[model samples]
Target: MEIQHHVSLKHYNTFGLDITASELATIEHENDISILSEVPDFSTQSLLVLGGGSNVLFSGDYAGLVLKNNILGKEVLKQNEEFVWVRLGAGENWHQVVLWSIENGWGGIENLSLIPGTVGAAPMQNIGAYGVELSSVFEYLEAFELKTGKIAQFNTTDCDFGYRYSVFKGPLKQQFIITRVILKLSKHPTFNTSYGAVAQTLEEMGVEQLTIKDISSAVIKIRQSKLPDPAVIGNAGSFFKNPIVANETLNNLKTEYTNIPSYAFDNSYSKIPAGWLIEQCQWKGYRKGSIGVHAKQALVLVNYGGAKGRELVDLSKQIQASVQSRFGIELIPEVNIV
Candidate 1:
C-alpha cells in the first residue's frame, strides 16, 4: 500500500472542498487491508474510510490517515426462483450498480437510480429515494474489523436501519470498514413510483407500461431536473434529513400554514420535508459569497466556488436555527461533518 503525505482532498470529495490529509492511503483490494492495519500510525492516529466522498464535509485539514476505498467487483453468489443474491465490492459506484441490475433484469433498486456515492456508503445511510430504501433490498455485508483485522458478516437485522441511519453510523461507527455488500434483488419487478415527482415524470416521459428500466429512467430524470450535479456545482446532495415530528405538531403547523406538506411516518409522527421548511425560511436561492442553499432544491447545500467546509457548516446551522425558530422543527444534517 502506498501512503502519500499532505494529500490534497479537493478531488476526493464531491463538494470540491480544499483540504489536506496528513496521510492518505488507497485500498484497491482486500489484501491491502492487512498491510494498512499494520502501519505504525494506523491504530494511533485518527482515521477516515472515504468511499465516493459524496456524504462528507471536512471542517479543516485532517490530521490523520484517510483511507480511500477503491475495492471493486460484482458477482452473483446465488439465485432462487424469485430473487438473485449478488455481492458487490464497497468501492463500486452506486448508480452504476443500479444500472447493472436493471440491465440484468434485477428489479429491486430501480427507484434509487442517479444517487451519488459508493455501495459501501449506501448501507451506512440506509439510502432511499422515491419510496424505496436500501433496507428493502439488503441481504448482508462483509466488513473488515479495524481492531482484529477479521472479516465479519452482518445480516439485515443486524443493521438496525432507520430513516437515513444504520449501525455503521451509530454503534458500529468507525469500528469496521465495509468490504462487500450482498443484496437480494427481485427477479420480478415491483414498481414504486409514488414518491416525489417520479410518477409525474413517468407520465411526462409517456411511460405507459412500467418496467424497472422505466422507473430508473424516471428517477434519473426527476433527480436531474431537481438536484444539481456535484461536478458542475459543488455539493453533497441533501444536506439535511427530513425531520420527523409529532402528529400534534403537524396539526398545529397546519393550522397556520395549511399547505405544509408531510408524509405519515407512523402512528403518532409525520415526516416533514426539510426543503419546504428551508424554503419557507427564505434561504432558497439565498447566496452569501461562495456558499448558498441550492436554488432548485433547498434541501441541498452548495459550494458555489471557493467556499470552505466551515462556511457551509455555518450556513447549515443558520438554516437549522431559522427552521427551529419558525416551525419548531430542528433539521439535522445528513452529511457527515468532520
Candidate 2:
C-alpha cells in the first residue's frame, strides 16, 4: 500500500477536471483489504472509492482520502456443459473483460465492448450498451461494507437493477466497495444485433456471419466513432440517462412531438431517447463558454478546455429544465457528480 497526501486527480477521471484529495491510498491486492479495517484514518476521515473514474465528475476538492482500487485478476470460477461462470477483480478494465470473454468463446458481454470504466463500477450503474446490461449476466458481487468493515455478497436480486441504477447507487450508496463480480456467460451463443447502428455497421462491413468477436469489434468501432476518446478530449460518455416516462405522459408528448423516438419498456411506461430530445431543443453543437454538448452526440457533455465541473452541471441542468418544460419529462443525470 502506498499512501500520499494532497493528490491531484486530473488524470484519474475521464472528464479531465482537476481536483485535489486530502489523502490518497492505493491497495494493489485484495488481501491488502484485510488491513483496511484497522486503519482508523478511513473511518476517522471522509473516503471515496474510485475505480477507472470514467463515470464520475468531481465537483470540487475532496476533503479526505480517495481510495484507488488497484486490485486485479480474472478467472473462470466454474464451468460445465450448460453454463460458465467467471469472477473478475473489481479493478480490471471492463472492456478487457469483454474482449477476454469473446476470445474464450464466452458470449454474453460482447455487446458491451468498448465501454469505459472498471468491472467494480459496472454493477454500480448496471452499465449497459446495445441491448445487454450487467444485470442480465450478473451472478453475484462481493462487496466490503464501509461502516461494518465486513464482507457481503449480493446476488442479482439483491442488486435490484433498473435502467442506469442499482442498489450500489441507491440505498447502498458509498456503503460498500465492490471487490469482485461474477458473470454467467454462455457456451452456446445468442447474439443481439437489433439495437442502434449495430446491424447497419455490420452490413456496411459486408459481414454475413457474426460471432461474439465480430460483434465486439463492431461495437468498439461504432463507439469510437461516436464518442470522443478521453485520452484526446475530455468526456464521461452520456451525461444524462434516457428518461423513462409513464405511458400516458409519453402519449401526451407524442401528440405534440409526433416523431418523438421512444421504446416501450412495459405496459405502463416508455423510455424516451434523451439525445433526441436534446437535439430537438437545438442543443446539439450548442456551446456555452468552455462547456458544450458534443456536436456529434447530444447526450454527451464535453469539456472544450479548462471548463469546471460546475459549468458542466449547470449546462446539464439547463438541458434537464428545457426537456421537462417542453416534454413534461425530467432528465436524470447518469454521470455520478461527486
Scored against the true structure, residue 151 in model 1 reaches a CA lDDT of 93
- Which candidate leads in TM-score? 1
Worst 10 residues of 2 by lDDT: 28-37
The list of candidate 1 runs beyond 4 A from truth reads none
Worst 10-residue lDDT window for candidate 1 reads 35-44
Clashing pairs in 2: none
Residue 211, model 2: lDDT of 89
Which digits, one per residue and each the tens of the lDDT, describe model 1 over residues 1-338?
A: 78999999999999999999998999988789888888776787899999989999998889999999999999999999999999999999999999999999999999999999899999999999899999999999999999999999999899999999999899999999999999999998788877758888888899887899999988888888888999999999999999999999999999999999999999999999999999999999999999998888999999999889889989999999999999989899999999
**What's model 2's overall lDDT?**
0.88
